[model samples]
Target: MKVKFFFRKKEPQFNSIEELFDAVSRKLSVIISVESITMPYGKISFKNIFKNIKYTRANSGKLNHITGHINYVTLGLKGKTILTIHDVGSTLNGNKIKFFLMKVFWYWIPALSVKKITVISEFSKKELVSIIPFAKDKIKVVYNPVKEELKYQPKEFNASCPKILLIGTKSNKNLENTIESLKEISCELHIIGKLAKEQLLLLEKLEINYFNQFFISYEEIIDAYQNCDLLCFASTYEGFGMPIIEAQAIGRPVITSNMGAMKEVAGESACLVDPNSISSIKEGVEKLIDDAEYRTNIIHLGLKNVERFKIDKITNDYLNIYKEVIEAK
Candidate 1:
């Protein structure tokens, strides 16, 4: 069967969704012919919408499987198309205008046009179903696959000043609270994304030892995980906490939020903390630092947890979904 995976125009920065699906497509291509369709660079306007519709319609007839972003849902290929919904974050943010637009473009329209929807986590599936109740039966949960390079590599914990890895710098990543929590703690903060000016000022004011970088490659990300003593990913919201699993695959214990998909993805292998509470974040970190045996246990459990996110298993899941969708047609 021929599969066409649609993606938005590639950005210079790292994009988790594109990187993940691209890896899956490469593996799936061994058994089936798979092609990727990327949109032309343009502002989101009527012209772009028309171009997408024409592009989608032009290729709809030749492909056995079609899958892409939920916002790109078009009318012509209902049974053959699958829309991937990362999260219903717009609705959850309490922005009425954004919610209205999301309902029309991301949910209701996609619900009418696509045969099925794939979500990264059960939390995301539930959130999407709550907004578009009719889609409950159509949404399937498929966990994100870890990259092949991120495997268990034993490294001694940095005893002088433990290096704590933080993946993103967005507000939802709860970086402010994390910084506050680490004010009195001794650790080298290795942040992966561009830091806001305010965040930099706060870091300076708090006197937190830190390093920051952005637009890095996959190899550098693996290096970050391999070098860190622990991963701190206490985000307030997430579609799926990919970094938690990535850190686990690299044999690092994780500290993540207790709510939303972070908790769901971390399972029992991570130390859960309240993203809104500085004290909670501090305590969690302290526990990991002070207790060597507990830290060692979680590391072992994390290694085991990463087994479920193997590329082969996730690729086969997508292939099965494609086969089922095609056979049904």
Candidate 2:
């Protein structure tokens, strides 16, 4: 039986999901669905990149029924389907009324009707059960696995002025608070991903100097990790913090929130802060900036903590879930 992966690209171009699929497939026949946001790329490229197994393309957005239909077709009609739910925080993170109403339409309806559920973090699994308890037994926790080979050499720390890398699109990243933190410090701040209109407006109002970086490759991200003194995650919420692990793997200390699965992944390796408070984020960075010995300690803990998440281990977790679905069928 063939396995189909459903992925929607919110951004114009990126291969985060594709890279994850590459780590999971070997002897199995794989199918990929791209959620094309910009100009549509050829579906054949996905097949070629994925060893010409099978692939397709579709428009992005709330298409739960359409997504289920696509999986049914790709899985040979009678084949069991495994659906991966990335995050439910968008529903819960914002306005309560909007979040509540959206879940009735975008989340619990056609979305929970899957043969199997793969979640990236325990935090997400908890959120899923809270929102849609019917999907609990079918849910499986599989952390996003990043290959170790992608890691590049880290640059030597420059003690002059620290460089803080804030990664994420302008929307939902809480950049206004981040900019407030920047004002308190003298370090150069680098921002990544596309900006939402409100974020741009906030940046203009703050009058802070920031670089809008467009990344063409993972190497660009790696470069940011290498050069930066700290990776300021500063996100209000996430299912699993991918960059936290990536930065730890690359020997950079992370400043992330203590809420949700962020703390689960970061543990004691990262300096936890109240993401709502710009003062808290500023204080965390100052400790790292002023204390040389503290930086060494955190980096050492980070190196050790990163080893806990091997890509192969997580891949095996996915394999076990796949086997369960097949056996049940």
Candidate 3:
């Protein structure tokens, strides 16, 4: 019954997949290996450090160096080893040699040793196959789970500012297009997480108001989603878009880029827009804010959309995968 759970250790906040793992770790016979590098917080940020991307460089080089997995394998005589591969971005689109080398090197090392691999989205599963096709049969698309309370409350809206919530890191997320889109859309753009100084300067030029994204408790997030008109995700690419699902769970209409797994996660529930097109984003925002029929419809659809991605369902999938691996061994 012993099993090992492995994840990137230095992520400042526990990732959603890891949170689910922690919630049931004690009940399930599992050990975890966390990558001790602070890559999540220090390197990938919304903060606009235009030059001297030191943290990103360090992250590129050291993102997947989970130093102790060999030890986990050596010690686990009777346990199944389950690896969660959140995304394959570093390997596929880091768009640099150092990043490519590190990600490519570390990506397959775990699959070779672990008994099973849990991917967050099929988008990531496809990429993992592209990296090392041998692991395709072993990789399972276990969607990331959300807390029950985030969107469990009744509907609430703030007509004051008409907020369009865009949450993501500044560098990779298409903040530039979001800012451009804001010029046409009158609503206040609420961005979550830090942005670089250059991004601040640009937003200032666009005459768009932005608040530094603060960390909110689960209740607060639910409240925010309940209040907003649309949960706008302008991310260029994601392995799996968690915020979109979280927003949908809270019964808010989502206006996210049709890129990556967002469309798959949102299905027909969200209004898909082009992340690169400011005009398209502007149009999507306007539809949500001005058209009541559209907003209410998507909200209902979003609630239904989130049902497919329930945490418990994903967890059960993982449990089955673990059982299969253990039985095969």
Candidate 4:
């Protein structure tokens, strides 16, 4: 039997989904012949979309899995197809016309082409079901497996001068709020994504020490995890917060938003704070800083939390689903 995992070409700075399923496909190769097809053109304009669809159809395998972020490409496939929807929050948040178009092309029409749908978190599954109630039975919640490269790297908590790692600069990441929360705190804020001019100015004006880096390799990401004292991922919205578990896997305490998928993915392992309130985020950060015992406890729980997202376990989950789809009449 043969299986093909379809992926969108990696953007210069982001390819988390592609990286994730690539690992799964590598493990799956031990059992069956598997191929990875990256679309020639990135998912953009009508011409590029049409080209990607045609290319995907020509290269389709017996069982096709469209990894997250390019679900609309499933429109051109046939046979047993599995599509992973990471989150609809980004797609559905916009002007009315854009929202309606994304709802149809990205979600509704694509739902008709695939045999099964997989979501990264239960929150994402519920969000998808709410948008297309008819597709509820077809949806499955498949938690993302933590990258194998991120091992448990123990680091001494540096309360004297802590380094707080914050990933993503997108609006949903609540960077502005986090920056505000860190204003008076004496710690270097290490931000992973591109920062706006206004953000940089704010950091300078507030006298908040920060280190900014963008378009780095995955190795750099692991390095950031290893070097930091704690991870602050207080995002306002997420389909699934991978960083929460990634930090947890690296044996670091996490301070994340209390609502949405962040809360769900973190379970009882993270210091939960209200994403909307700067005071709440500040409190969570300080709690992890001042109380070494509490920080150690969180780190312990985080390591245990990551076991649920083990790569072998998650890969096996996909293997079972693939078998069910391939053997279906």
By TM-score, the best candidate is: 4
Per-residue accuracy of model 2 over 1-329 as CA lDDT, tens digit each:
33444543224355566556555553222332222222222343434423211333232222211221122222222235566766776645568787876676455653445566677889999988887787688777888776665463566676677788888874557777888887757777778787778777877776766777764577677777877878888788787888888888888888888788889888999988888998998888888888888887888788888777787677667667666766773
lDDT of 1 by residue, 127-214 (tens): 8888888778888998999988787898898756899999988889999999999999889999999999999999999999999989
The global Cα lDDT (0 to 1) of model 3 is 0.63
Q: State residue 132's C-alpha deviation in candidate 2, in Å.
A: 1.6
TM-score of 4: 0.98
Counting clashing residue pairs in each candidate, in order, gives: 0, 0, 9, 0
Best by lDDT: 4
Local distance difference test, each candidate:
0.83, 0.66, 0.63, 0.90
Order the candidate numbers by TM-score, best to worst: 4, 1, 3, 2
**How would you encode candidate 4's per-residue C-alpha lDDT over 125-215 as one tens digit per residue?**
9899999888888899999999899899898888988999999999899998999998878899899999998888888889898899999
How far off is residue 296 in model 4, in Å? 0.6
The local lDDT score (0 to 100) that residue 2 gets in candidate 1 is 83
Deviating ranges (above 4 Å) for candidate 4: none
- lDDT, residue 306, model 1: 88
Q: How many backbone clashes does candidate 1 have?
A: 0
The CA lDDT at 161 in model 4 is: 80
For each candidate, give its TM-score against the true structure: 0.94, 0.78, 0.79, 0.98
